[model samples]
Target chain A: MIYEEVLSGHQQELRRGTVVMAALATLETPGYGYGLLAVLEKSGLSVDANTLYPLLRRLEKQGLLDAEWDTTESRPRKMYKTSQSGRSLLDSLTAEWNYLATSLNALRSEEPNTPLKELP
Target chain B: MSSLSSRYVTAVSRSVPESQREDVEAEVAAAIADLREARLDAGTPPEDVERAVLLELGDPMRLAADYSNKPLHLIGPDYFPTYIRLLKILAATVLPVVAFAVMLGKLLSGGDAGEIASGGIIAGLGVAMHMFFWVTLIFALIERNPGSKEAKPKWDPTTLPDTPPGGVRLGDTIAAILVALVAVAYLPWQHFNSPFTDAQGQSMPTLNTELWPFWIPLLMLGLLATAVLEFIRYRAGGWSWRFVAINAILELLVAVPVVWLAATDSLFEPRFIGRLVTEGWLDASLHLNVTIIIITIGVVIWNLIDPLRKVRRDTAMRAKRVGSLG
Candidate 1:
């Protein structure tokens, strides 16, 4: 259980940065908070509503996300989309991510060789 | 809007900034409605969905913190170190001095040993609490004020002072200031009434009343100087030659008058001493004058050596850093 907790913590830390990138990328198409959560989950990036809602508001405040309230349906929904600046930020972040992945792969390949044993 | 949804919106809006309240409330309300609608479309019970949605959003206060960018802590990590440092300084310096003064006052008033001990403890705790309350309140204000600049400036590794090993903390200096203030304020007040009296009904003051006009003002001035010096030392974060010089001057301002008063046998009323001696309450052979003078000189010498030692330690650290770089 402790090992799982530690693993989960490390996983959360790793996913935190990726979640931001993924959110910005997915929000290129306009979506409400709940709708966006579904899209993110379907894409294998599960985030809590409490976390997602605040992130959306912070992104809007930073001028990286645009939001509009649509009252056309029975229930009003606040739809969010990536701003032009958000798209630009997404591109730069993607480039940086690629560079990091490539460097990490290179370092992994340089590790000392180990013999693999067949499972009994 | 449903009752739960409206309640959540109200709770969040109450904690948020006034300007952002309406917008935040509207956004939260819309989010809740969307969640409810989605659940209803999927055939989930309306009652179950409403409770689930609010639960998923977690505490309204925490949500409000994220929206308003206000920290949940009283003093944020940024200012916590400095706050604690100042607190320690007060606890070390001011607490002991206040305790000593109260103990002395009780003793001179002919209070029993237990009463003196308890009185000292109460006074020390009271002053320490006041120091803690005010310091925390100030730091909390700084943390909450969005317009307030950062307490510490941007860091540059090369320019940063080397952390002296077991260095004299900023708290010690602040404690000194607090102690001085207590002493300056308490001495005059305690002197106003005689705690002792002779069988002939003559009142005997703690200090000679004649020393009031010349001694009190000079002592206060010296204390005020120490306060100013401590304030500067706190801001600088470490010792320098300049701090040492100012500290020496202030120590002299305080120590000279004290030594002079003791040497001239003007610290305590001679009549009071004589009466106590006559009553066999005090030893006739006791050299009260010489004892006080020695104590005053001892404190002065100690104060002078403390800053000089810190200065030397700082200098040595800097030289080591330079030597390594070279």
Candidate 2:
């Protein structure tokens, strides 16, 4: 049980950074909250519906995502897509992530016996 | 369209801003409907899907918090340190001084020891509650209104001044100790051979001589503690939790006896007051005891306010430095 809790915590920390990247990548194509959730799940990032909805709203509010209500559908849906600035931010973040990943890989190769320090 | 979905939307809308309530309600409702449609397409029963979709959305209040983008905390991390520092200053200084005043007032008015103590405690607590309520309310308002001018400035290490070698200067501490020593030594002597004398050639001491045995020793102990605190402050160079704790203890030690003396009406020499009142040297109706108590309370308040003001000045200066750098 303890090991499971620790593993879940580590998984959460790992997913935290990817969630933003995943959201930006997926929202390049306009999608509503539920549809975006499905997309994220298919992409192996299973975010809670409540979490995704708010995150989408926050991103839109921050001008990183553009949102529009598609009333042509039977049920009106607030569809979201990545904004121009959001695309630029995504590019920068991607570059940073790649650099960080490479550095981590180099470190791991150098010290195979050293374990990552646990967060308090 | 489901009752459960409607209820959930209503709960969320209630907690959001009045201007955005309608928009939020419509958006949340649409999201729920979309989830229900997906479930129905997967062959789930309508009633089960409705319940499941609402449950998956989680708590409405938490959803509202995210929607608002405002802190749920009474005091956010930004202003929390300032809040704590202000609280300590009030607790150490304002509380004891107010308590002392109330006790003094009760004593002059002929209140018994128990009555005086209780009154002082009640008054102290009242002031503390008042301080806490207003402080929390202001901080909460600042938290809710994020872009307000009262918001904490961006922190920078360069903004911090080099900490002085000691918080309390050696000269100041020595001067205070000397003054305290004089006052302590003079109290007993003054009790017996007061500068003021009656027509009958008997010395009319200001304070009741009967209280000397208990009062003088207590006063000496308090002064000694104060001297030690000053030394500690001089050595430490800045306010720490330990320094604040010791300061509070010393304040209480000093305040209790002074308060007790005043409350029990044992501060003034009755004979001296009576002689003066009879000889027309003093006004018969003048509330000398009450006036003395008021002066003591005023002095305590002034002392307390002075240090707090300096701390505030220092904080403002640092904030100004950071602002300039930005």
Specify the highest-DockQ model's number. 2
Clashing pairs for predicted structure model 1, backbone only = B89-B171
DockQ of each: 0.56, 0.66
Per-residue CA lDDT of candidate 1, range A2-119, in tens?
Answer: 9999999999998998877988998899888888888888989999888888888989999999988887977677888999999999999999999999987876786334222332
Docking quality category of candidate 1 according to DockQ thresholds = medium
lDDT of 2 by residue, B1-326 (tens): 86778899999999999987997898899888888888899899876999988888988998888887756788778878777777888889988999999999999999999999999999998999998998889877877785864658466777565865424557887897787678767777777778888667877887787876776778778778777777766665544455555766666676666656676667777777778688775753246656656666776666565566455444455566568999
TM-score of 1: 0.60
Model 2 Cα displacement at A36 (Å)? 1.1
Model 1 lDDT per residue over B1-326, tens place = 77878999999999999999988998888778777777789898866999988898889999998887889999877778778777988898988998999999999999999999999999988998899899999999998887766445344568555754643576787688899888878677767666678668866676777877878788888888888778777665557898888888888888887777777777777777778788776663247777877888988899889777778776676577668999
lDDT per residue for candidate 2 within A24-81, as digits (tens), equals: 9888988888988888888778998888888888888889999998989776889899
User: For every model in order, what is the iRMS?
Assistant: 1.1, 0.9
